[model samples]
Target chain A: MSAENAAGTPPLLDVKNLSVRYPLRSGVVEAVRGVSFVLGRERLGIVGESGSGKSQTGRAILGLTPQPGIVAADRLRFDGIDLLSLPPREMRRLRGRRISMVMQDPKYSLNPVMTVGAQIVEACRVQKLAGGRAAKDRALDMLAAVKIDDPRRVFGLYPHELSGGMGQRAMIAMMLVGEPDLLIADEPTSALDVTIQLEVLKILDELVATRGMGLVFISHDLRLVASFCDRVLVMYGGRIVEEVAAARLGEAGHPYTRGLLGSAPRLSGSVHPLPVLERDPAWLA
Target chain B: MAVPTPPAAQHDRGLPAPPAGLKAWLTSPAPASRTQARLGRFYRGWRGFVRNPAAMAGFVIVLLLLVVAASADLIATHSPTVAGDLRTERLLPPGGEFWLGTDDQARDIWSRIVHGSRVTLVVVLLVSVISMPVGLAVGTVSGYAGGVVDAVLMRITDIFLAFPRLVLALAFVAALGPGIENAIIAIAITAWPPYARLARAEALQLRGADFIAAAKLQGASPLRIVAVHIVPMCMPSVIVRVTLDMAGVILIAAGLGFLGLGAQPPQPEWGAMVASGRRFLIDQWWVAAMPGAAIFIVSLGFNLLGDGLRDVLDPKAAER
Candidate 1:
């Protein structure tokens, strides 16, 4: 809590007028349109529906937009460096070492052919952190840090061999092994069961608290985001419709936010039918 | 080495009359070291390979090929190349002093076939060694590096694929001049396009996979991603394909030899032997029939092995 950040110093990541567009034969489909936000060393959640560009925003931050998807941001800066102008080689050097992203599905994110330990060691060694035995030891330490009971046994395991929770933890370990300053987790716990979800979240929570790492937690679960994130950005039709403190999420003035809240089936309220969200034409504007 | 005690494992929950020593070691639920893990994986693949009867037959046949190629000189009763008492031995049928009869030159058929196994082995080995690497490299790079690189490499692959393999190989032999080495080179050149195609297809599938994306996000260079990750996933299929292709390679080598462009006279190349035997095909069937049967059996063996390997190594098959 006492770690210093002088007043005139920039935030960990600064994004202004960020847009991701995919050119189809028919027309240009703007996935994220003029979306802008800044992230400090805090847990910031982006909540949206399936096509709501939360994942794209996270990917765009790390410059992981797929080929042919044009990413344009007026000022996309990370740790005082201009991410927009950074060459691929320099971007690659910055990735995993200074900035890392944990993809949603651990099943797919972890390489099936490689052992968990080998993947972790690769992420570590490629950053020029440690070599040979030391890198291996560091990887093992990371697995244990994620609260995996038997790091040694799991290290030799292929991704398919591990259950969902274990694989998710191993994914986290691989991401955190390089010790990046900013971590972008894209719906990390969606594929996991309820109990496993909490465990994964706890691990992420601890890392953010102890290591002072900035986290962009992208998920659609309003309640989960409200409980976990310090602040929330509600995205609609590729734009930020509402931004509110996590505690005041219920009091958000946006009709879309109210519709999203109204749609959820609450155990306490004995409502016969859940309210469906009304499609708004003006949110795109 | 002293036998170390087993580490307490989570998998040891339902232990009822546990296994001991060798069986226990082989059946060990969790391997302690990297060597153990690799050996265990290989051992499992081997187990899968041997389970099917046809694959086993093919494996045995390939083994026979190796043994025969290795000790060709020791097994033969007479000299393969040197003519002996042409008056008595010429055009003799099977079950005489000569087995499988003699060629027009009065050389022993059995001896020639035995010695010819050596040539067959060399051609197969040389072709595979040269072709698989080339195909794998081109395919993986092209697939992983998409866009211009992908387009350019694929077009080049398409050009190679457009040619009929044997005709292209024949053309290569014509250009390079005839010899066993040149024939093998030609065969190798024709052989790699298919592998490159196969590898590229696999690379295309893998390049977009979540694991690859994860690696990309984590700063893995394109070369590292292609070689380390994409190539290995493509390996199981490549290996299966290569085994299958070996049969084709053997046949191609024999075809070149039959055309008199492969091994020179007196070397006992199977295809050349078949060519010579074809002269006396009507009356003296054993001369041609023997070499023809040898080629058929060897090719069949390689094919059976390849089929069995597919059952074991094919990822899709593994799921079933």
Candidate 2:
């Protein structure tokens, strides 16, 4: 892939050693431990099972971890801007403008009372990208870009009025209207049907490529990641156990990655029992 | 190569024609005019209201009281404050001159009850208007801005809630001095704590909602998040609470008036009128009974309206 060949290009996001810890009465639980990865201006997928801290890793990048979640990193930078030490006011300016996140469930993520157009316009207005008629125009254009059949009609509809696929598309439209340089999509299509999922993926793939924006696609579906992304980072117990080119994912060296691949139910294979993932304490260490 | 068509009689044999009424009901078009659409909406709401007997009764009583309060000038046969000849009119039975009889002061009891609704309703409105915004702001700020801010605001709210509502209002009124305005201020001060508590609970629930997180990610300020996102979600329950609390506010204002701390005598305040008629309760029942009944009816109306509002506004109710 071109992303692999472009080795000399500087990474858009650089993380040396990042850790997220939550303190409890019992003890401090380390959700993410010494995780490090560099994201270039290409599609990079982070695949992991539930409790693997994949979502936390995405939230940590955007500084969206909830209260009592202590995020620590040796070096966390986005385009050489030190994210760790950036003031909240400056971080606010960078958040939706430079780096935007599309949450897991569009049903819960979009404001229920606000119209599709108003929400998109708010995203643009908050970033100072556009205002009033210009914002409305940009919002409509973004809606059309996301393949919404009737942008004008959909614009006035509330989130609950739209179906699951339409709501997800609206969310994407709202997030992308600001034209952020980097997008972190946390399980954006998990709540959708298979057919709708493919359509959403297509729109995302085209947008990422056309905008030349870096994408950190977080999900558990390995086959999808391999097909859609240029590179994949396999996370296990909050650590990056493997990193491989998406095309070369089948030949991954890590046992965990191999085990994940083996667990998938195949269409052509004989009816052998699926292998359960075996955990090793050393993986955590 | 010619295709054969099904006979028209064969097509008719396949299915029976639907009843005209059923067909009309199923295929009725949307309302043609804006006014028609509005009326349709109102009709649906009214139907839902009428389905609940208690709510309907409450609505009717509240509506009747509102009409009586609004049209006191037209309804009352005589001036509420003007006293008639004491020897001739005092303690007269319900008849020609005085419809509901006269007080010991020879003032028209019916006229006083009708005019007294104005004072009671004003108190209710003032208390609600004053308390709701104050409580909403307090609760939203406290709940949304959790941690030290939440801790401090909630502790203060707890202190206020610890005192019994009526006792607190009485104390405030006693300190602020007697009269309708002071009584309103007292009731407003006491009324807000419950709203704050309700709003705070709602805010806490909504503070962690995904939409709130999304707004934060969109670079919305704390104020904007609370105002635009948190407040609207919290308002439905708060409104229901306000409607319910209107009953209590009316009662409290009347209590203050009875104690001579609100709506001073000769002003036709319901509670003060009731107080004045106490001396002649046995001799002239209508004097106290008339205003007392008015108070009871108006309070009942507010309570029923509040209950109906809860049924209508609650999303959970629709689900059930």
Candidate 3:
């Protein structure tokens, strides 16, 4: 971490302590609790089960915690701009322009009525990046960049017309069109085929390497994160239970991390009835 | 989208050529250009609409109304309101120079009914134009904003919706003074609440949709999100409602005209003609019946077309 910090250059994103609470009729339900991390130009993965606050944490960074969800933090800064206190109008300019998040389920994330090219073009031109023809060309180029074989033909297709993997790639293209510094991908490849997943990861890898983009990859697949990201954050009970280098994930000291690791089905194992993760009350503390 | 045929499948001869001409061009599996794609979409919807015979009848009736309204001047032989030789021509049976017979004032009933199509068209167009936007904007904004805004806007919509449509329109016309323009305003005011309610329901479902969230992530403002994202989703339903409501609007216009609160003397409004001819109904049945039948057929046309449109345009019905 110390070796990667260049002199006089701030990290692309910095979070001191961020918490998100959804106030319900019953009571306030805390979704993310005191999670803090700094992201440079490298891939960071968040591994957690559903309802473990992983997706909410990513949403908080993008200021997209759906209405009625309250967010607070000591400091949430992106490229030196105070995200916690920035005016909404200013925040909007930064949101998809400097930072963007890829949502789960491309079927729902992409507009059903709009053709793929129009949506991608909208993503590019939303920041006043380009107009009409140039934005359209960039959209087609982005589609091709995402490894779509026939970009022009696919561009005119609607979201429902595309297969799952193609829809996911189209969504990724929409997010990356503006070349944001930080990209938070939430379960991006969960709907994809294994081969398509690898192809998509290769696209993400290329973007991170060539564009120096900071990535927050959130998925429950621990092994995939370990193989793909440089650093990994393990979340449980609305908090970060462990943080470790992707290479040393096998050597993680935390019990929860080990439990998750032990629970995954291994190719070499003859073990039946894979280990069920047990709850520890103290982890919430 | 076009896949190559396998050698074994060659017996099919490359999926037989599309249809003969226009249908072939319009329903092409892979449209060559944007215009073709749009037309293809429309052609498919048109085909769906053509399947229902009742809806086709209604569609034809509406088409006839439009043509008749547009060319009323050319179609009506005599002036709609001009009276001639009252003692000799008045209340003549359906024959000779007066196909639908003469009215109490010796005016041609057929000419008047033909000309009255223009009045109906104007009322329908003006009412929809004035009210659809207002209802859509209010309902969409309220639903998207939710919370206090939703409650307030909805309560206001409730107040408007509580009144019986014709009663509300009648009250408005009585206050604004009797005339066709005021009648249209009254009808428009009464017509929008149902649209608002429909739009609000649609917006509620769409407000939490992922595509809307995606638009927000793209930094689209609330106004843009509502206008661009939410409104389009709600449009199919709104359009269905508009078509359905056209019947109601026309009814209210006729009701107002019946009460003498719309389309004063010489206007040739069907309802106004009915009102005047009702006095002579015993001896001159066609005088009142012709205009009344016109009202029934036109209203039925709108209702049938509206129902058929739901099957073609409403996403829920379209899915079914």
Clashes of each: 0, 0, 0
Q: Write the per-residue lDDT of candidate 2 for residues B48-103, one digit (tens) a residue.
A: 78898988888888888889889999999999999999888888878988888888
Per-candidate Cα lDDT values, in order, are 0.89, 0.86, 0.88
Clash pairs, candidate 3, are: none
Q: For candidate 2 chain B, which ten residues in a row score worst on lDDT?
A: B1-10
Top model by TM-score, which number? 3
Model 1 accuracy (lDDT, Cα): 0.89
Error of 2 at B293 (Å): 0.8
Clashes of 3: 0
Evaluate residue B147 in candidate 2 and report its C-alpha lDDT on the 0 to 100 scale.
Answer: 95
Q: Tell me the tens digit of each residue's lDDT in model 2 across A20-120.
A: 99997899888899898888798999999998999999999889889889999999989879998998888888888889989888899999988989999
- Candidate number achieving the greatest lDDT relative to the actual structure: 1
lDDT of 3 at A79: 84
Instruction: Judging by lDDT, tell me the better candidate of 2 and 3.
Output: 3
- DockQ for model 1? 0.73
RMSD for each of the candidates: 4.4, 5.8, 3.9
Those runs of model 2 whose alpha carbons end farther than 4 Å from true positions after fitting are: A1-10, B1-45, B315-320
Ranking by DockQ: 1, 3, 2
